[model samples]
Structures are given as structure tokens and as C-alpha cells.
Target chain A: MTRHRAAATLMPLMSLALAGLLVVAVLDLPPQSGLAEPVAGAMDRAGVDHPVTAVLLNFRAYDTFLELAVLLLAVLAVWSLGRRDPIPARPVQGPVLHGTLRHLIPVAVVTGGYLVWVGSSDSGGAFQGGAVLGAAGVMLMLSRPRELPMLPAPLQRLGLALGVCVFLAVGTAGLLAGHGFMGYPPDWAYPLILGIELVAALSIALTLVLLFLGGRHGH
Target chain B: MATDPVNLQIYLACGALLFVMGVHALVVRRHLLLKILAINIMGSGIFMVLLGVAAGGEGGVDPVPHALVITGIVVALSATAVALVLMLRVKAATGLARLPRSGPED
Candidate 1:
């Protein structure tokens, strides 16, 4: 693609002006010092000590659920486009890649699990865990580097739907119980969130890996 | 919003800088991949602005914005992945890496 010389020259100038305006706008902001009492209470009610996790899975679970849906939909759109050329265009066996993946995969899985576990109480969460797992999948793909489906069709489909379905089901169950959508019973909040995170992590991990793989492999 | 207004200003400025750079890239770059990268940069900038603004609110670093940023990162990646796939498809079907300046409005 030939570069557009005029646009290229103008861009930096325009960007600088925009940056200046943003800097000016930011300078007017006021600082906050402490957590408000009501917010602190909401954190407590979230069943998770970490305020961020509380917000993600409790106060605004709908957002997280929708995020998962978006991920799944992205993969579906890719699949709908039809098959991808086998990765590498040329198949070459790499003993080096195998050696690295052989060790790296276990670490990825363990770290992913650890992140998911710690998310409720600390900085880690489903997205981070899913990323680690997805990274492992990419490592696997590098070693295998095939156009063929590494996973069975049914499993791929299942993974794609798993997170969203679990989320929706729980939300619906809450509604049935008259607790409002995605509102867990107070007594069950902790376990419910933990379980949902685990399942959502699995779905996210698989969906991401599939999307990266590009096109439908698992017929 | 930020707990410290100084940090808030710094972060929002950073975000703004990134967004401007991304917009520049999107306009100036001819490659599809570069455009996608530019979009991701813009997304990150927006996320930074979001967190920066929330951190400066009446209450300290609010959970809501933090969660939203986290969600945004994941969503951004999903969108980038899809965009990359689309780019690849376009390339495969046509020999060009990007649409011609005046293609049929893809």
C-alpha cells in the first residue's frame, strides 16, 4: 500500500493539537482521598474483598457477562468466514517449540488457575486467567501449527457457549428466585461468584484461542 | 477520577497522547494491520481516560471504573482479533493488504 503523503504529514500536527487540548482538560480535575462509606458497604456486600472484582462480578456483572458474549460472538464471526489456511503455510516440525511448550503449558495452566482463585480477594481475575490459558493454547498451536482442528468440533462449540450460558442461567435463576437478574442470594454469593468465574474463565480461554487460530478448523 | 489529582492529570494526558497518536496512525497508515494496531492504541487510551477520570472522583479509585477498564481490555482484544480476521480475509480474496482509496465501501 502506497502511503498517502499529505495525510501522513498532517497527522502529527493534528495529533499534537489534540494532545494539547486533552492535557488542558485533564488539569482541571479534582482529587479524591477516601472511599465513601456507602461504596465500602457495597464492597462488603459483593462477597469479595477486592473492590474491582466486586464491581466486575457483583455490582456490574451484566457488563462482564456481555463481555464474554462479545468474545464468543467474535469467534463465531471468524468461523462463519470459512476455513483458514493451515498455519505456517509450510509444515515444519520444531523440536525447540515442542520443548518450550512442554514446559510452558503446565505453567500457563497453573498460573491461570491461581489467578482465577485469587481474583475474589485480590488483583487477579477471570480475564487474566483466561489470557494465560489462551496463551498456552497459542503455544500449543505453534507446536502443532496445523489447519486441522486440534480440538473436536463439539468441544469447541461447547467452550464457545459455556461462559455465556452459565452466566445467563444463573441470572435467570436469580430472577426466578425473585432476587433480580444476576443477583445472588446473600448466603450463596461467595461460592456463586467463584463458580461463575471458573466457568467463564474456561469459556474465555477456549474462545480466545479459537479466534487466534482463525477460521473454522473443528468442522 | 483519581485519588490524587496530579496522577489523574498525568494519566489523562497520557491517554490523550496515546489516542492522538492512534488517530494519526489510523489516518496515515496504509496497511490494515497498522490500522488495527492504531485502533487498539485508541482503545487503551480511552480505557486510561476512563480510569483516570474515575480515580479523581469524590471517592477514592472507584471499583466501577476499574472493572470497566478490565472489561474494556478484554473487549478490545476481541474486537482486534475480529478485525484482524477480517483483514486477513480481505487480503486472501484480494491481493491487496488494504482496500483501495475508493473501494466499494467495505
Candidate 2:
């Protein structure tokens, strides 16, 4: 009991001390220009027009690829846990919501596609688009009629693996062509990055929806 | 435009406080859900700090940190999903949504 009390008391003090140290560290950091200049200098050579896209897809493609793998791994872990219990039927169907969804889902799909397309030159990208698509899928899952039609098992699996597989294939191709692994040739950067983003966006959308489902799809 | 130094410091301080608060919550709270939430708060704090640092640079905002934070967000989402499922399994197996009181709270 006394030990518990001591630990409880000490935790706040420790946290506070840590916070103070962090503030001091932040204050001590010298003001300096970040990697903006270097990134800018390399922009033309980068496949994409947007600085963020350039960094994400070109300069640091490995990190993004691993991120896709992490998403896939997460779904695998969830599926291994057990089957997802079916959603209980809602007694009261709100017609308004169903009506709205009827008009909204197609728009959401178009918006997601636009986001992915605009990503090369703007603030939107694969993740943003995929998230939007995932939201639409979730809406469908939640509000659709009880006998919701799920994608066939194989197709679902394909969608889930699409991102990482495509990314790996592209990276390996780049390596075989004398560009480093995950690197783009000077001329092929744009098309290659866009292709990766499109497939990655599809995979990301599927992964998010599966994560929402929370377990294995079928029996 | 470069962030004003004073504002940048303030943002950094806020981020630091958020991270500390998250750590405090994660340690003090016993509920599995709260712990997961606390972890997310900590992630948000780190994102804030990274963006603050990105903004304080000389010529332009750093794209590297922006890219990093985007990756972090997606990773966090996946992690949270896995954690939530694990929590559900724990609940199903043990019939408790919170951790057993084997620590300070006990």
C-alpha cells in the first residue's frame, strides 16, 4: 500500500520534471533553416511538383513503403484475432440518412479520386484520398441494408496487398534499371510516382475499411 | 513566411506540455481505452512539435517533417486499430475493460 502511494506520488513529479526538461530542450534549440533549401534545389529532379509529394514519394520513398506494410500487418493481426461479429440490425432506419448516402457516396468517390489526382501538385494525396474513400465505405457498412454485399475474399485480399506489392515491384524495377532501390530515374519520376500513389491509395482505402470491420471477413 | 520565433517557442512549449500530459494520463489512467487515447495524444504532441520546428526554418517550411508527420498519422491509425481490437479481445476473455489494479492504484 505504501509502495503504491509512493509510486503514485512520484509519477507526477517525474512527469513534471520531464516536462520541464523538454521545455528547456526546446528553448535551447538553435534557430536554423531546415531542409527547405535542399529540397527546393532537388525539386525539379523529383518526380512530383509538390514539395511534400516529392519528399514522400521520391526522397523518402522507403519510409512510405514501410508505412504501407505496417497498415497491411495491422489488418493481418486483426484478422488473426477472430471473426468480426456481424453488426446488429438497427430497428429504426432513418430514411434521411439513407437518402443522403444515396447521393453522397458517388460524390465521395469522385472527391477521393480527385484528391489522388491532385496530390502530385497540391496538398491532397493518396492517404487523404484513401481516408475519404474509407469513410464512405464505413458509412455504407453502417447504414446499408443488413445483407451487405462484401467483396469476394480473394479480391479483398488483393486490394489489401496492392499497395505494398506495387510499391515493392516499382522499387525493384528501379533498382534493376540502375536507379537505386525505391529511387526513380530522372525522366520516369512523374509517371512512376503517380502510378504508385494510385495503387497505394486503393490499398490504403481497403486497409482502412478492413480495419473498421475489425476481423476476418468470411467464415 | 517563417514563423515568428516567439510564436514558434510557444507552440513548442504547448507541444511539450501535451506530450507530458499524455504520458501522465497513460500512467495514471487504468482503462485500456484511456491508455490508447493517451498514446494518440502523445503522437499529436510530437506532430505539433515537428510542424513547429518545420515552420521556424529560414527560407521555407520543411517538407521532410510534413512528410514524416503524414507517415506518422497513418502509422498511428493502424496502431490504434490494432490496439482497439486487442482491447476488445481482452475484454471478451477477461470480462474487464480496464487493467487489473496491480500497480499504484491497487
- The most accurate candidate by lDDT is 2
In model 2, where do residues sit more than 4 Å from their true spots? A88-91, A216-219, B102-106
lDDT (tens digit, per residue) of candidate 2 on B1-106: 8888899999999998999999999988999999999999999999999999999888889999999999999999999999999999999889988997777542
Error of 1 at B99 (Å): 3.1
Per-residue alpha-carbon lDDT of model 1 for A1-219, expressed as tens digits?
A: 234556556567888888888778766655553443455777667888888888788778888999999998888887887655765443366876667767888999999999999998999998899999988886676566455556777877998899999999998898899989988887788999999999999998898788877874533
The structural similarity of chain B in model 1 to the true chain B, as TM-score, is 0.86
**Model 1, which residues run further than 4 Å from truth?**
A1-9, A32-37, A89-96, A145-149, A216-219, B1-5, B102-106
- DockQ-based class of model 2: medium
- Model 1 vs truth, CA RMSD: 3.8
RMSD (Cα, Å) for all candidates, in order, is 3.8, 1.9
Q: Which lDDT values do the candidates have, in the order given?
A: 0.80, 0.90
lDDT of 1: 0.80
Q: Provide the lDDT at B83 for model 1.
A: 86
